[model samples]
Target: MKTDRIMWGIVLLFIGGVLLLENFNIIEFYWGRVWRFWPIFLIIGGVNILFTKNKSQIAGIISIAILVITLGILFYKGQQPRQKEVTISSHTEESNDLDIPRDVTYSHPYTDSASVKTILNISGGGTSFDLKGSTDSLIIADVQRKLGNFSLETNKTDSITSVSFKMKGKSKWNMGEGGNDVDLKLNANPIWEVHMNMGAGEVDFDLSGFKVREFNFDGGAAALNIKFGDLLPITDVNIKTGVADVKINVPVASGCRIKTKTGLSSKDFTGFTKLEEGLYESPNYKTAVKKIFVNLDGGLSNFEVKRY
Candidate 1:
């Protein structure tokens, strides 16, 4: 067989095997760590080009062996836990504009006047953001960082309160040293609409105690884990991602529906019945009083929805 065809077959086999293992939960692969080694592809391509002109059997064997060895290394690394000591250095000249890093705590007092509806907007990248508990205050945020500037602003218009928390500048991420970490808590008194835009990082949010009407996330190359509660009659979640691992959990008692527009992505929806292409619903969807609707749009991602 031609070396080119052999190389293509090997690539396909590797990809298919990894996807199968990941979908079945037999192995957990971290794409984030593997992505950093993208230069391996370039090396493989250069070797193939150099040997293609020589049609000798030895040339083909050498090319195939190199491809297999490189893929093996990638497979092994992908299965390993992400190293906390990994550091991401920024090469952009704009890095000098970043502010001195500091640790800060912010709180916004809750008042009855703006309890009707609350909108929370978060924007940042290269950090970990988490929401775990409810707070008596309107919102509380604790930020620990080694770089970048963090700010929070709030405004009230009639009965709706809008809160915006964001990182102001770009900075290098030295995970071995320290990076931006934000822990957040929000009041459960008012109905909430949350929107988050992040370039990359990890997000773990538990909004089970809050009355969430709408939740939206737009991210790239990230790991996202979110659990939603049935505090409201209807909850809508919309997520758009690029190269991500997304896991969502919903209460088993609530009716849930999922609509996905994911291309070349692996999906596993446990305890869900397929109604049609790109649509799934829980068994109690038609009769349950409370319902959740999730919409996923992603590219090259792993998506899972589990009823808990």
Candidate 2:
């Protein structure tokens, strides 16, 4: 057999076997742990190039052995527990030193009438953001930061309110250092439209109690989980991501249509039927009163939509 063919076969088999084991719950692999070792691919390519002129059996065997050993190391490291970073808590003591990190709380009053429409804009990176429960105020944000600063601003126009929450400066990563964390709560009265831009981090939002009109997210190398309710006549969701894991939950009774433009990505739309290329629809799409439209565009990511 050709040496190139042998190398390609081994690569495919390793990837297939790892995915199979992950699907069967035999081993949990953390891709983040393996991401830093991406330079190994460059080394492998160099090795193959060096041996290209020599088509001897010994050269092929050496290449295969190196590949196997590199893969073995990655497999072992992926299953190991990640080291925990030191995190700052809200109750941490205050210090006179300016270098000490501190917790901050921010809120915007719910002064607008219930009939008003509200838009929330969020932008940040290297942080964990969560939205859950309802608050009497328009919005409440509690931030715990080890570096950088956060800002919240609100503006109201005729029949509409806009709230913006964002990190002010870039965050620098240090070894064994903690990251910023933000917890957010929103009022349930106003019809909401949420837009978020995240460079990298984790996001968990439960908008099941609010009347959400539209939701949008743009992120890179992040994990996102969102659950939506059937409180509105129609809900629109749009997401664009790169190298991320995204999961969305929708009500089973609500009709849903999904359209995706994904390149080198995996999708699991379990309860939806394919209507056409890049289009899927729930079974009750035609008859259901409440409907949801979802559009997803991603590169090298995993997308899953489940009914709850």
Question: In model 2, what is the error at residue 103, expressed in angstroms?
Answer: 2.2
Candidate 1: worst-modelled 10 consecutive residues by lDDT? 170-179
Candidate 1 residue-wise lDDT, 1-308, digit = tens: 48888897897678667868988789987665565454576788889989999989999999999999989988998888754432234433234533334457788999864348999999877677889598889999987654677788999898888999988766322221244678899988989999998776678999998899999999876778899999899999999997678999999999999999999778989889999999999999999999999999998778899999
| Model 2 Cα shift for residue 106 (angstroms) | 2.0
Off by over 4 Å in 1: 1-16, 31-102, 171-179
Residue range 51-115, candidate 2, lDDT tens digits: 87797889989998999999999899878855644444444535433245567888998977788
lDDT of 1 at 220: 73
Q: Which regions of candidate 2 deviate over 4 angstroms? A: 1-24, 27-101, 171-177
Pairs clashing in candidate 1? Answer: none
